[model samples]
Target: MRRSKTILLSLSAAVFITGCSIKPEPLLPKDIKSSVKKDLQLLSNIVKPITKAITLEEAIDRAVNNNIRNRVQKMESALAYKQIDMVYYDMLPSLAANAGYSVRDNYAASASTSFTNGQPDQISGTPSYSVSQDKERTTTDVSFNWNILDFGLSYVRAKQQSDKYLMAKENEKKVTQNIIQEVRRTYYQTVSADALLKRIVPMKDEVKDALVQSRKVKLQRVSSPMEALSYQRELLEVLRSLQSLERNLMNAKLELSELMGLKPGTKFELSEKVRKNYDLPEIKMALEDMEKVALENRPEVLESRYKERISSKETTTAILKMLPGINLNAGINYNDSDYLLNNDWASYGASVSWNLINIFKGNTYNKIAKTQIELAKEQKLAVSMAVLSQVHLSIVNFKQAKKEYELSKEYLDVAEEIFNLTEVGNDLNMNSRLVFIKEKLNYILSTLRHSSSYANVQNSYGRIFASLGTYSDMKKEEVKAKKVEKKLVKKIMPAVEKKEMKSPTFKTYGIATSNLNVRAEASLDSEVKYVLEKNKKVEILKTISIKNDVWSKIEDGYVSSTFLEIQTTEVK
Candidate 1:
């Protein structure tokens, strides 16, 4: 029975522990649904979609205007400024006004015994006086108090808050620079992916057609089973490779959409038309100049300096706490009572108070302040070191990326020339079908590599700019001149009108409410060809039910019906 009771107790304890355990907030299907709903509402209001090619400048502006992360940083900076205001109020004199009612249970009396005779042993007379005090009374008072020591402490606190407010601005600048860097990187990736996809998409269709013809030819011939199977396998492998590349291209587009704060799967074209022999920015400044620029302008370095100032002011505040306090107070009071004292009075007073124990603890306070100052200085030094290292590394990486991109271009050009030669030979019946396929694959692969390298070059430049804590038009020659003239406005840009494409005839159109897949079939496990961004327009041919979920068929593919907002239904 004892054993059974112990088991029961253990079970009870387990239950209690489980009940008290903390759970992470609801971050699953419900949160996802909520976010989809919000995106749908936001996109529905956007009448124009990006149909024309988007310039890098335009893309960056859109991201800065729409990104929630930048807005969050701006709000944080505003909160810091409000904190400075609150600290400033602390330096003002404290004023208080109060009124009260009091009741007494009895009258008050006083008596005095006096010896009128010059003899020490004799008491001449005894006199007494009595006065009836009111049973109830009302009193009111207004007072003002000012402590010089506290005011000095508050001044230091306000100064620290001001420095912290500057720190917030620096932090905002840092976040903005990072955002712009991301825009540059993702923009290049999107353009590269799009370029590669356009080239491979037609190639994929041609290869699929060729695969069908080859299988037909194999079946018509009385060839060895091994030979036929090998031919079929080769074609399937080619198809598989192309499919994988297509998927990667689709994913790259989705990522770009996300970075721009657009609905996932949104389709937009980039302005960079040529894939090869593209002109990119050149790094003109030397390493010394880069180091100097980074040290002076990098947000992290500036923020560290501000933090050191704030810490020094905080140390002053801590020392002030250990000092003696001197205060002045003034008040006027009014009372209504049936007593012989004055009913109204005005008074003023001054005081000086010190904690005697604090005198003995002065050394400890001084040590703490000293330690904090040293810590702040060390932190500042560490940040400076990190910034300098980042500048040097970024420059090296940029140069390396440029070299790699140039090499990739050479490889792509050679592949293109070889593919062209193979195509001509195949047309003249001098080259076998297998040789043509292999050359085509090589060309496609080289194209993809070239695109990736191009993106890397852009990303490297983005990193360089980020390390320097600035963003500017890379195509422009004189960045330093523009930086000096431009105001440091971290404000959001105004929304611009995006060009919209017209719909095809008799097509039922809908907007995607979430990032959704365009699948080969109306099934959950169907192969996904494209990912439609939220707010992207799709032509819906019909709707079909796949188990519990409804799906809409478009010209090229099918998508989930739950997140599709049919335009005609809404219009009606």
Candidate 2:
């Protein structure tokens, strides 16, 4: 009893000490400053170095390849895929090995007494005492348990996981499309800035000179006070507009830098020549066809379909839970004891257990599961409707952008002609130099407008494709995780065969572990088409997950996934 009290007191003291150690502590200012400095330095190092001028195509590539948000989505899709592998383990039978060692200060002793009728015969009873086990001993056991109900549940869960992985891939596609759109918009704006920066700088000096002359004219009364004040007002208005444009032009480069995942204030040059149509073949499709395409390819629509599958599986899982369970258990156990006839033995047994009370709740649970499935279907339809709306809206925006581009082009031509005539001294109200400066500024404004309007037109055109989900086929024909093994993973899931993944399905880096054979299909029995050299880099196009094995369709052909490592992103 004394020893027990001492042990309890020791445990209480230890618990108090641990509790004290866990008190909340705030970071010091110096520590936070050091962390910030370290992270900024690391951020500067990871960005790929730029060479020469960056074109629109290169800008898109940089954003897709290095944008932190884009990379995160790729990693997320990969994580979801890996989870499918983990859930498969849960479906397997429970195999466990246990080992134990025990010691005591005294032996475990039991006494047996002789009895008469239903009670001990105190007058003639004899009692015996025995110690059957050693004071110190070791025990070990290995067990295997399989439950039919649990297996069914795990199978359903795996199906859900497969759908989830596909959904994540679809989301990644949506994010890539967004990145491309953003890069295109920023690239054009930056090109406009680069083209106008030099011209705008010299014009500022002319405007300042004109403003000073107008102020002097007003003070000396060389002209009417009203007319001189009006001239100064014109000069001031032009300067304000020019300054605003300059500020906007200056920030365009910064926005592009951040989008491409480069450090802030990183200086880089852009190609002055804008990619008018971005090298993409003209998008020509009827509204009806576009709607059809959007419905077929939009990530939101696909994600909804995947969600519906998850819900249907949930219904099946619920049913499995309500049914009876049959468990089969087998184990082998051993004991180290001096007084035992058999120190090792095996056990086998089967059990059927049903909660009769669950029958009362079965109908309600089934209804709830079915209702959830209906909800998922409704959500899918809603997403499909939204996708169609975006398609129509993108078309309208494209038309408006086209008209604006034409109008800006006309304005630029007229402004340039007027500036030329004034520079030759055609009556610019007698002050041809100042008037020429004003005309020069107008021409510059028109040029800037032309660039901005054209950029909008390109963005709107891309939006049409983006809304249709065809932007998935981007530069290099590879937007991050280009939809993955949809053509195959779909057949492997969906409770049936469905949608196919269109090319190019993404290419990620992987290495062959051996002289791996590339098969015609995701099976061993399929004909082996080619062999890969060990340790060679393989361009993985599609990844398929089958029962216990994984296969990747690479440039050569389908190879065992176990030998290939998929790197979602790499820092160089």
Candidate 3:
């Protein structure tokens, strides 16, 4: 019987535990439906059984929509939005529902049998006995509270949350812009590298042909062994350069793919070539115009502005701390000696509270908030200066790069003409091998310079657009420059603008005149100045300062018009 009773007690205990335990509800199917659908779509896109080349824009779109980092930013923005909602809701009355049950058993003597005051005389003559009984009880309650008046704390908190949401939204935009820029930059770099590899392939073939011809001449006793060895060394050098270029090209492509947030080991083929065919924008306005654009469009500048606004709100909130807070609480409670609804009882009441003594503590936060506003102001000034400098530098680089590209094209044409004449002279046995090789080297150097100059122009444009936060607009403006006619008085140049000018007679000077010595001279307008310096035996003259110092001309003839500071020192 005792064993049976023990099993029965264990069963009762298990039931009681199970009844008191809370079970969490399963996630609703609709909760994750959107996420599941998105994942499936991404999987389908990536696993599609076709090999189609994706454009840079398409890649960037896919990355922004599906990339982990971007998705995280989006989620953070959403969370901030929810937080703002929560803060607003804090100002409203809250309602809550609660229910519970309990059971208990007590072993004690009944009070009815122990109390016999009138029968004391009979009780004294006979022994008194009391019967024991068991008692059981259970109860449950529900309650809620809401702040009635908090001295604008709720409103200030909501405003702060709203600012946070705005900041997060701006942060999301910043991340997206950064991702797009990275994708575009890496895509262009890969395309450029590929173009360079294509250019090097023919050069490598030419070196191989020259090596073979030199070896044949050596066997025929027409060329010395030393000459053949020189050809071989030249071929080896060409091959090494080719290999390095190829490796770099591959690395660039891989990097681009990675930036697009592609899976590891995925291959990407650029659909377009990195040709230097884009026309420069007609930027007639001064550097100040570009700086304005940067200030308005740059994400960092906008973010800083938002931060300053947030700090202002925070200062107001801190000052409002001097006021006392008042809260109201009201709730309904029920109690019962049994778990039956009929035996239960209910009660409700309201109360208010405040912290009047804490107003003296508000001064500390107010002072801190004032300090924060000053810090924000300083930060804004620093960012404005930095943005101005960046815009100025980018403009100067664009001008100088355009010039170098034009010069490189002219140099390439001259080198090609010299190489053609040298080839003819070599065939007629009038040109020595050394002379032919020198001409070949010049031709190769010119080609390299042309490629480098083209790359520089493209990079400068990229930087300019990047600073303006509009690099994505380049997709619509790619075009090649037109060829111009060459005349005695007006040289119409290819890849450069044509202008009419007087042709001066060429005269040799024994020594360059000191009048050509360009020094940093302030113009009649003190804001404008000119500077000159000699480098690598070449004299370079530059306008060091404009009315507003829009651009700086470097010794290399490259002009950097962006607002970036140029380090200058007194010439010894």
Clashes per candidate (backbone, < 3 Å): 4, 0, 12
Instruction: Quantify all predictions' global Cα lDDT against the true fold.
Output: 0.73, 0.77, 0.59
Worst 10 residues of 3 by lDDT: 494-503
Predicted structure with the largest TM-score when compared to the true one = 2
Q: Would you list the rank order by TM-score, best first?
A: 2, 1, 3
lDDT at position 278, candidate 3: 36
Off by over 4 Å in 1: 1-52, 100-138, 217-221, 265-267, 338-341, 427-431, 472-572
Model 1 Cα shift for residue 539 (angstroms): 47
For each candidate, give its TM-score against the true structure. 0.68, 0.74, 0.63
| Superposed model 2: Cα runs more than 4 Å off | 1-8, 22-38, 112-128, 214-233, 272-281, 426-437, 472-572
lDDT of 1 by residue, 1-572 (tens): 57767988999999999988968786799889999999898864433467788877777777776677887899999999999999998999999999999755555665545555764443336655656567687989999999999899888888888898999999998887878778877777777677667667676776787777666666787566577677668777988998898887777667666656776666678875434555666777788888888888888889888877776675677677778999999999988875747888999999999998887777787787778788888988999999999988988898899899889889976775555444322321112566777777887788678878877877887788788776653435323322221333221100001011122222356799899999998888899998999899977666555445667778889888778776532222
Which residue window of length 10 is worst by lDDT in model 2? 490-499
RMSD values for the candidates in order, in angstroms, are 19.5, 27.5, 18.3
Can you list the residue pairs that collide in candidate 2?
A: none
Better of 1 and 2 by TM-score: 2
**Please, what are the lDDT tens digits per residue for candidate 2 over residues 1-572?**
57867988999999999988996789999999999999998888877898878877778878988899999999999999999999998899999999999977678987866698999755425556689999899999999999988899898898899999999999999999999899888887888887777667667776787788778778888889888877778788888888988998998888899889999988888864532222222445688988998999999999999999899887787677789999999999999899989999999999999987777777877888899999999999999989999999998998888888878777765664454334322222425445766777777777778879878877787788899898745353333312223233211111101112222222356687778888989899999998888898876665555655667767767888777644532223
Report the Cα lDDT for residue 540, model 1: 69
With a 3 Å backbone cut-off (N, CA, C), the pairs that clash in candidate 1 are: 264-533, 265-532, 265-533, 266-533
